[model samples]
Target: MIRYAPWKVASIILGTLVAILLVIPSLLPVSTRESLARAAPWLPARAIVLGLDLQGGAHVLLEVDTPSVVRSRVEALRDDVRRALREDQVKLTGGIGLQAKGVQLRIPDPADRAKALPKLRQLAQPLGASLTGAVSDFTVNEGDDGVVQLMLTDAGIDARVRRAVDQSIEVLRRRVDALGTTEPNIQREGNDRILVEVPGLQDAQRLKDILGTTAKLEFRLVGDSGANPGDVEQLPYYKASEGSGTLPVEKRVMVQGEDLTDAQPGFDSRTSEPVVNFRFNLRGGQQFGQVTAENVGKPFAIVLDEKIVSAPRILGPITGGSGQISGNFTVQGANDLAVLLRAGALPAKLTIVEERTVGPGLGEDSINAGKRAAYVAAILVLGYMLLTYGVFGVFADIALGVHILLIFAFMVLLGATLTLPGIAGIVFTIGVAVDANVLIYERIREEAHSGRSILQSLDTGFKRAFATIIDSNVTMFVAAAILYLFGSGPVRGFAVSLGLGILTSVVTAVTMTRMMIALWYRWKRPTVLPI
Candidate 1:
C-alpha cells in the first residue's frame, strides 16, 4: 500500500487538481465564473444548473387539442377521397361527408359500387413501412346500400396522436431555447398532455403567448366561386380594419409555411419599417413562383392561424421565392414573428390546463436551506470521524472533501441538474463517504491487536476491508440505477447525485486516504500506527 508507482501518484494528483479547478468555479459568483471562462477557455465551462424546484420559474401543463387534430385529418381525408373518385371517373354521387369515425361517400348506383370499391381500396395505402404490409391508415368498406365508408384505423389515430405529442415537444423545446431560458424541462405527461418546467424564466405570459399561437402560415388567393363572387374563407387580420375589414381568401392554399427555409427580422429599406423576411425551400419556391406567375394581378392573403397577416397583390412574378411580411409591426413583434416562422407551427393547438409560477424568493430560501443542511451534515460527520480516530480520521476527512469536489466536477461534466432532492442526496453522501474509512480503521485495529507490524497491519486491513466496501457500494449503485430507470423529475436528479457520489466516495476513501497515509508514513518512519 505504501509503494505506489510514480505514475499512479501523479495521476491521483492530477485528478484532485482537475476536480478543484472544475468545482471551484461553481462555488464562485456567476460573473466571476464567466470572466474566468473568458480568460481560460480550456477550463470546463459547464456549471451545476439548479432545477425548477431550486431556481424557481414557470410550470405549465398543456393538453393537446386532439379533437381539432381529428377534425382536420377527417376534412383532409374527405378531400382526398373526392379527388380520387373524380380522377378515377367513378360517378355515383351523394357527395363525400364525415361519419362517426371517418368519411362516408354515397355511390347511389349498385353497378358503380364494384368499380369504386377497387379504387377506394387502392386509396387505403400503408401507414408507413411494414414487414407484413398488414396495417393501413384507412379501410374501405362497401355496404349493401352502395354507401362506401372510408374509416380511419384506430392504429392510425393513435400513431397520429403520438406524432403530434412528439412534434409538440420538439417545437416547445425550440421555442423555449429561443427565449434564452436555461435547462427547461419539456416532457410528455400522458397520452395527450405535455408538462413544461422552465428554470429562471421571468415572463410566463410571453412564453404562453408564443405557445398559444399555432403560427400556421398559408398563402391563398382571394377569389369568389359563384357568379356574384361569394367569399371563400373569411379570415381575421391583426387589426379589424384592413381591406374591407375581413380577409376574403380562397380556401385552397397555394403555399404554406412548412415550405419555408428561413425567416429573419429586418427593416424594409424603402419604408424604414420592421418586417419579417422569409425564404422558401426549393419545392415551395417553385410552387410560389408558379402561383405568382399565373395570378400576376390578383391579391394573395398571408394567413396565420386563420388570421390574415397581410394581403399583397402580385405586381410581378416573384421568381426568387423570397418575400417580406409587413403589417406595420414593431421591431419586437417582427422578431417574434420571425421566431415563430423559424420554429414552424405546432401540429395541433395546445391548451394550458395548468399553470404555475415559483417565485425567486422561495427558490432562494430552498437554496439556503439545502446549504445549511449540507454544512451541518458535513460538520457532524467530520467531528464524529475525528473523535473516533486521531490522525487517520483527519486523513479520512480530507478524502471526504475530495470526494465531494469530485462529485461536483462529474455533475458539471455531465451537465446534470441539481434539484432539492439532489441536495438531500449530497447530504446523505457525507455519511456514506466515511463508511469505507471506518471499516478500514476498525479492520486495522483488529489486525494490530492480532500482533501484526504497523505497516503489515495497515496493508492487511485495506485488503480485508476492500471486499466489504465493494459489495456495499455496488449494492448502492444498483439501487441508484433502478431509481433512475423508473423515477421521474426530482427522483431522477436524486439518483444522479447519489450514483455519482458512490463512485467518487469509493475512489477517495480507498485510494486517496491510502495515498495520504503512505506519504505520511514515509516521512515519519513511525514504528507504530497513529490511530
Candidate 2:
C-alpha cells in the first residue's frame, strides 16, 4: 500500500518508533523506570493505583471480632466492681452475669445495694461504659421499703462498637506498615470489615498467613500422651510427646515460638536433611542456654499448636545459643517456612471472604475498548484534516501517524502502563494534536494566496505559527500538570495523556513535519505549493 515510500532512513525511524511502542512497557527495565519518572516530572512516579492482578500483589479483608471486644470490656468492668466493693468493705455476694446488653449482679439485700451505691459510682466513673437506649443517670431511687437499684445512662453497644472500630483502625495501620509494603490501600469497607490492597506483592497468601499466626510463643513440658496425671508427673517432660492427637494425654511445652532472633532453612550438618535453624539474641540466648543446661539429656518437643513437628533426642547440653528443627523437607519448602518464621506470627486470624482475579479476559476486553476508541478518534481527525486543507491533509495525516507512533514508543520507553484509560488518552491526543499542524497549514495557505513564492509561504507559515502553537500547548501543559497533581486512578491517567500529548504534538508538528516538508521541497521545488 505504501509505494515509493520515504527514505530507508525514515522507514527505520518509523519502524523503531513502532517497535518501542510495541515492546517497551511490557519489558520495562528497572533502570528505565527511574529514568522515565525523572524525565516526566509532571507525570508522577507515585500516586498511581497499581491493581493487585497487574502487579501480582496481595489483598485482604479483615473482619474485627466485635463480640470478643464487648465481652472483654464487660469482664474488665466486673473486675473494677469487685475491686471497688472490696475497697468500700461492702458485703458482696455471688458474682456478675453479662446479659445481651446489660449486666446483672447478685447481691444480698436492698440495704447492701444502698451501701454499694457510692462505690458503684466510683467504679462506673472509669467505665465510661454507658447503658443502651435508657439514660443511666443510675438514680438511687429507693422504694418505700428502702430498696435501691443501679441503673444506666446514654452509652451502649454502639459506643463499644465505635471504640473497637477506632482501636482496630490503629492496630491495622500498624500491622500494614510493619509489612514494609508501599502505600497500601487500607480502608474501612463497612463497620466491621477492613479492605487492604497491596501492589508488587510476591504472595497473596502471606497476608493471611501473617495475619493468622497468633504469635503466642509458649513453652510447657511435653510429657507422655498416654500417661495419667500421676504418671505425667512421674514420667518427666520428654515422654509426653510419645503419644498424642486423639485421646492422648497432651504435655505442656516449656519454651515457645518467641525468644528467637533469626531463623532460616539449612541442611542438617550431621544428616543431609532439611531443617529450620534458629538462633536467639542476647537475652533469649542466655535463657535458652540456662534451660538446656538445667535439663540436659531430657527430650523436649518442638510443638506447634499442640502438634509436634519434630522432637530430636537431647544429647548433652546445647550451650551454643542456637538450635535446629530438622524434618523431612524439600529445599524450597524449608526456605519458605524459614521466611514465615522470621517475620514473626500474626496477631489475629484472617479469612478470605472474597476473591476476584483479573484474568486475561479483562485485559483483552480493555485492549479492545481502547483500540476501538482510538480508531474512532483517529478516523475523525483524519477526515477533518482532509476536509479543511484538501491535498495537504494527506501530509498532516502522515505526520499525525508519526506522532502517534512516537507516543507509543514514548509510553513503552517510559514504562507508562497502557491502561484502558491510558489508551483513551492516547486516542484523544490524536484529535488534539492536529490543531497544531492545522494552524501552520492554514498560515501557509494564506501566504501562498498572497502572490508569494511557495518557499516564502512555507517560511512565513512555520515562523508565525510557532508562537501560536507554543502559547496554546503551554496552557494545555499547565492544565495537564494540575490534573495530574490532584487526580487519582483514572483521572490521573487522563492527565498523563494530556501532559504527554503537548510534548509529542510539538515535536511531530515542528520537527518531524518540517523534516517532511524539507524533503518534499528538495525533491520538487514547485512554483506553487501543492495545496
TM-score top scorer = 1
Per-model TM values vs. the true structure: 0.93, 0.53
Q: Which stretches of candidate 2 lie over 4 Å from their true place?
A: 1-336, 339-354, 383-395, 446-457, 467-498
lDDT of 1 by residue, 198-273 (tens): 9998678977887777889999997654523443866666653534467567878899899999999999999899
Please list the Cα RMSD from the true structure of every candidate, rounded to 1 decimal place.
2.6, 10.3
Off by over 4 Å in 1: 125-138, 225-231, 239-244
Under the 3 Å rule for N, CA and C atoms, how many clashes does model 1 have? Answer: 0
- Candidate 1 clashes between residue pairs 3 or more apart in a chain or in different chains: none
lDDT of 2 by residue, 82-129 (tens): 777677666644565554433556556776777787767654443353
The TM-score measured for candidate 2 stands at: 0.53
Clash count in backbone of candidate 2: 17
